[model samples]
Target: MKNILKVLRAERDWSQAVLGEKLNVSRQTINALEKGRYDPSLPLAFKISRLFERAIEEIFEDDKGEENA
Candidate 1:
């Protein structure tokens, strides 16, 4: 997945640690998410959605042309 997490955080002038604190996660987790090295769980996704006041789809996107069997 590709997400606009970094952009959103930047827009708000939030550090990774600040975002992590708001999301109840670690700074490393936020960094991983921003770097696309990890995917968030459903609950975490909802938390992010609520925090940003944006729909999950607006924040996270499924890579196109990828299909599951």
Candidate 2:
């Protein structure tokens, strides 16, 4: 999965630590997600989409594209 987490965070002028604090996660977690080293679980993904006021589809992309990669 690829996400626009860094884009949203930067647009808000927030550090990973700041976002982590808001999302109740560690800075490292935010860093990992932003770097695409990790994909967020469903609950976390919902929290992130809510925080950004965007839909999940807007934030995260299924790199498999349509049917297959």
Candidate 3:
């Protein structure tokens, strides 16, 4: 999955630590998410979507190109 987490954080002028704090996660986890090294679990993904005021599909995208399926 690819997400716009870093971009959203940057837009809000939020540091990874701050974002982690808001999300009740760790800085390392934020880093991994920003780097696309990890995909968020369903619950965490919903948390992120709610925090960003965006839909899950708006934040995270499936790279499988299965939208047409």
Candidate 4:
């Protein structure tokens, strides 16, 4: 999946580590998500959505277009 995590974080002047702290994840996890190397779980996705005040769709995208696949 593709996501705008890096962009969003940059817009807020947040480092990956800082984002990780806010989400209670490791910095490496944030890095993986930003680099499209890992996908967040549903609960984590909701946390991200709420933190950014964006819909999950706005933050993350299903590159395969399989209805959230």
Top TM-score hit:
4
Candidate 2 on 1-69: residue-level lDDT in tens?
Answer: 789999999999999999999999999999999888999999999999999999999999988786685
TM-score of 4: 0.93
**Superposed Cα deviation of residue 51, candidate 2 (Å):** 0.3
Predicted structure with the largest lDDT when compared to the true one: 4
Whichever of 1 and 2 has more lDDT, that candidate is 1
TM per candidate comes to: 0.91, 0.91, 0.91, 0.93
Candidate 4 stretches with Cα past 4 Å from truth are 66-69
Which ranges of candidate 3 are over 4 A from the true structure? none
Q: What is candidate 3's lDDT per residue for 1-69, written digit by digit as tens?
A: 788999999999999999999999999999999888999999999999999999999988788767766
Off by over 4 Å in 2: 65-69
RMSD of each: 2.1, 1.4, 1.5, 2.3
- CA lDDT for candidate 3: 0.94
> How would you encode candidate 1's per-residue C-alpha lDDT over 1-69 as one tens digit per residue?
799999999999999999999999999999999989999999999999999999999999877625642
In model 2, what are the clashing residue pairs, if there are any? none
lDDT of 4 by residue, 1-69 (tens): 799999999999999999999999999999999999999999999999999999999999887788655
